[model samples]
Target: MNIAVVTDSTASLPHELRTEHGIVVVPLHLVVDGQEQVEGDDVGTDWVVDALRRKVDISTSRPAPVSFLRAYEQAAKGGADAIISVHLSAAMSGTADSARSAALESPVPVHVVDSRTIGMAVGFAAVSASRDAAAGRDVDDVLERLERRLDASSVRLLVHSLERLRRGGRIGGAAALLGSALAVKPVLHVQDGQVEPLERVRTASKAIARLQALTVENHDNLPEWAGGVDIAVQHVDAGERAQGLARTLADALSTKVETTRLSATVASHVGLGTIGVAMVPRIAD
Candidate 1:
């Protein structure tokens, strides 16, 4: 049966990959200075970074259920028998809830997955699911592969400050880090779908180093069944540092690393100079 893969813009999947896999993307909303714009479309990472630097009021909202319903209908019209809609962490945003609500009214069978992670972590799962569907796998088989990919993926972040996250209410247990020393640089990770503080360092350099070490540790701990891994380096206005980290990881891991800027929606909450790494174990053929 022909199946389609749908994901939100916050997944940060490259446009080429989305086109190659025939994946449908529904954009989230970003409000800057009371002007609500669509993420990645009406607003971009650069614009968001500029707004943040200027201290413009910024906030994000999940796509309406109708937006997802329209996407589902279009996919069905495109000849899809079913669809697997993947989204960022429900704990972080209500996007998954919107997808689930739309699924109820979808013309075709819609299976919504809360990745429990964000950025390329969710992107990686959606890509894998699309491949499985393209290979003629049934819905159950496709979901099985998607789950395996999600289960083996990890995301780590190094943000300049916790202020943006705090303002957006996305900082879970990391809220305590705000009370610590002003010099403390936080290394955070997505745990059980919530942003949690992983380590505290006194310098940004030390925090970045710790972030790379944690990524390496996560890569080393993968099970033998995972044939290989895919790594994505994401940043917000920290291109130089992100490129350096990606190169270091590529050489150390003996694998290719992709570097991309975070989506406007994510960057708004993470703030500028935020660096993140997403590692996903490749499924063996």
Candidate 2:
């Protein structure tokens, strides 16, 4: 049976990679205040970011069931007997739920997976699966690779501003105030499947240094630390800096780097200058 893979725009995959592989990408809506703006439709990343800069309501909406249904239908026509719908973490958003519901109504059998991470973390899983499928692997193999990567992965995000986060209800107004006062650069971590604060520094340079230090410490401790594993370096409105970050990380880890720009959708939440580094942990039982 021919197998197909599907995912949402929140994955923040690069345009080149998405185009190379025929994976179907569904977009989730962005809610500007109470009004709903469909992903890639009524509102885009620029619109959301501008609104946030102006202190406008910056709410995001979950993908509707109909979106998944459409992708499933197209996959079915392309001779897909089975489909794997991968999405952002359920803890962060209800995108996975929409995929599950759409799967139930799909013409082809569907297996929905919650990547449990946003941006390139989710993108990595989908890319891995699509590559496996392209090589004539079965659906089970694709799913296994995805799950394994997630199980052995680490994510670190350096958010430059807390105002957007405060407005989004991620950080309390009080905490945001304290964070700003202390120059506390909160080091957000992705553990198990949720985004949480891991540490806080007093400067932007320190935060970037902290990220590099962690990569060196964790990766060096790995049993199979062959120079470096795949590092997906990303940032919002920092594509130019993305290259420099990648180069610096490569020098520190002595490994190759794959850098990409965050889609406007993810930037709406991470906000501007949010630098994140994600890597699959050293293989462990």
Q: Identify the leading candidate in terms of lDDT.
A: 1
What are the runs in model 2 whose C-alpha is more than 4 Å off?
33-36, 41-44, 170-182, 222-228, 281-285
Candidate 1: tens digits of C-alpha lDDT, residues 40-104: 75478988999999999999999999999999999999999999999999999999999999999
Prediction RMSDs, each to the true structure: 1.0, 3.2
Local accuracy by lDDT, each model: 0.92, 0.76
Instruction: State the lDDT of candidate 2 residue by residue for 63-179, as single tens digits.
Output: 789989999999999999999889987877788999999988999899999887777777777877787788888888778877877776677888876666655554422343443
Residue-level lDDT for 191 in candidate 2 = 66
For candidate 2, the lDDT comes to 0.76
TM-score of each: 0.98, 0.88
lDDT measured at residue 76 in model 1 versus the true structure, 0 to 100: 97
